[model samples]
Target: MASTWRTRKADQKTNLAKRRSPNIAEVSIPTHFRCPISLELMKDPVTVSTGITYDRQSIETWLDMGNTTCPVTNQDLEVEDLIPNHSIRRMIQDWCVANHSYGIERIPTPKIPVTPAQASEILSGIAAASRRGETTKCRELAVKVKAFAKESERNRRCFMSHGAGRALAASFSAFAAGPLENSKTGVLEDILSALVFMHPLDEETAWHIGSPESLDSIVLILKCGDLAGRLGAVLVVKELVSANGEWVEVMANTKGLIEALVKLIKEPIFPQATKASLVATYYMVNSDVERMASRFVDLGLVPVLLEILVDSEKSMCEKALAVLSGLLSCEEGREKAYEHALTMPVLVKKMFRVSDMATEFVVSALWKLCKNYNEEEAEEGGRRGESLVEALQVGAFQKLLLLLQVGCSGSAKEKATDLLKLLNGYRGRAECIDTMDFKGLKRPF
Candidate 1:
């Protein structure tokens, strides 16, 4: 552990350097948002003397609720982060309520495969070679790492997990920044690929997060402000928590994970579509539910996500709708979801807007969202309270029924039937059933 005096000494030296510099520093706005508690222009912008100042109050709320650090600062920021910038607190409050998702979710980066072990072994060998002044060996090792990362890309591979991928990517980057690079596009491409692989995309594949080594690597990876790298990492952390079902006890350990995940909103490499997708995805990572209903909720995510949900691009729409379904699922499970859910309506209208593969993925996502409400939450299966049933009653029911008619295998047919049966058992469900005309209801025991 680092000692306090050491930390203080470093802080003092940093202050001295800043004071010694000829130019005064510029106030840093997080490039991301207006203030939340008070949505004004976030005037009381506090850039720490140490050069890291996030709105303390916002960071504090996330932490006092048992989070470990500020999502923006990755600092030891706790409740003190909530110390309001008294000057602009009111303005910040207004902005919080006014800002919407700008109709974009920076999409999660495209995924790649390179194994953590493979990347690690190669980077370590290069680092050792560099230390020994063996430029030849270092260059050779970098070549191998780049080649392997490239090969994994060719396979259109999904990463092992976000943490593992990022850790591996960080190591690769250290090698690239130090020993590799010559203004060549090929070298630049390798760096970019490594960036994507640094953190796997959310649900690009299932997240496997029990590995301590992978987690450690993830912490190292978050140090670099490469926007794409951190965005991928956040999705992995958020999705892993999502995959864990409601094990909030296991989730407290992931506060560091959340901080890394939220930090992406401040970076530039994040596009409007990708950013919206991430907020929708990560916002759903709260212990049991997504925080969409909170008074302090980040509403800036909504409009952007809605845009992608309606996009003409099949892959983009598929991902957007998947995030929407996850968001809608959380809302639907509770009766309160009525005020916030727009996903089902948008989904129904855009149902036929894409390629069959993308359509299949979206339908599968919708199915899982419904399935969780039906099968997993059984005893609490107040079908009346479920968002899935509510969606069925509105407009999306026909689209789902249409999906059932598609020429898929018997298993797909069976799953759809099972979901239908769950909704059918609910109190005002007959009205929804009346909307679908699939008459061949053969009972599959």
Candidate 2:
């Protein structure tokens, strides 16, 4: 039956291919006409509005050489204009013929039904099954779990059930350290990431009792050797260190965490995993944003930040923006560092990307980074003080001005206005530090 169907399909395509070009699309190839590297269509097409074109052979050569210059106009295609090769042209034609012959579109691929909760449940079940030497059962469950966990945690409130949440995490850890220790199967990183990093346990959730003290668990989990475990551990540590740490103290203790964090950042497995680690390191270190700025600069974190900023796939730019904020806070040669930051246009471009500039912590950071260098200056102070003033002045005053004049409906705008007053001079800066508003701000942007 299959062979007969394929033969009929071949006959149908032969009929279509033999027929004259359909009225669906038209072409009038000229002397200098060629296929666009982008559309790959042959026509008397006008050169792009950008005013660039090339010859027929030139177009083919460019299409062959991956040159994005317009065939007739000779203008180079922009980063945004460069189109991918026509990958599915043949497949599309086959579909057209097959559809005209078969009279039905292809059935959609069956979606694998798996939630994060379900994924975690499977991992837990695997550990339970593996412990009793149930290899077959473990393999069966693993087979059903798809290549990746796509579902996000549905409710932040779910993790508020501190007892169940902690117990579930502990149990997952136990499984990894116990029977699964020797199993050649993959370590349970996805499961753990879903458990720890997902919605249930954010800062406001406040269900877990592990503030600062539970730091060891994350380290242990990372050491246990699973991507989920490592990420989970990193999340836990990040949450813990941040439960409370002054910037100076985080930077003061930076040495102890650097080696461990560097090891995590260098890991090749997951870019998100490495990014989370470096960002956490960038976050965990306590310093006047100035004090630790040079170390990260010396360690060559600037270029890595630019790389993450341009990658739009992951939300990694948030962290990269943060590291930029911290770098802006540095006083010593801050302009040079700012110059280096301009290398990637994305970071500067994306600063005002948030909805509420006043309340969005990164916005304030961007505010500081974007300002006129002198008026926002704080060079008279120590490295830390200078960095802080730089942060306040870096376009923050302008954002604050906009906030004050235009105003925001949210309370964060009021808070930002309040924070802005502090930047006006030492007295206001002292007032900002002396006031209570600064406490909740340490972790956000």
C-alpha RMSD values across all candidates: 23.7, 19.8
Candidate lDDT (C-alpha), each? 0.45, 0.46
Candidate 2 accuracy as lDDT? 0.46
Stretches of candidate 1 off by over 4 Å are 1-125, 129-224, 228-252, 262-307, 323-337, 355-394, 409-412, 415-445
TM-score for all models, in order of appearance? 0.37, 0.40
Tens digits of per-residue lDDT, candidate 2, 144-175, equal: 43233232122222222323245334333444
Which candidate number has the best lDDT? 2
C-alpha RMSD of candidate 1: 23.7
Q: What is the lDDT of residue 18 in candidate 1?
A: 67
RMSD of 2: 19.8
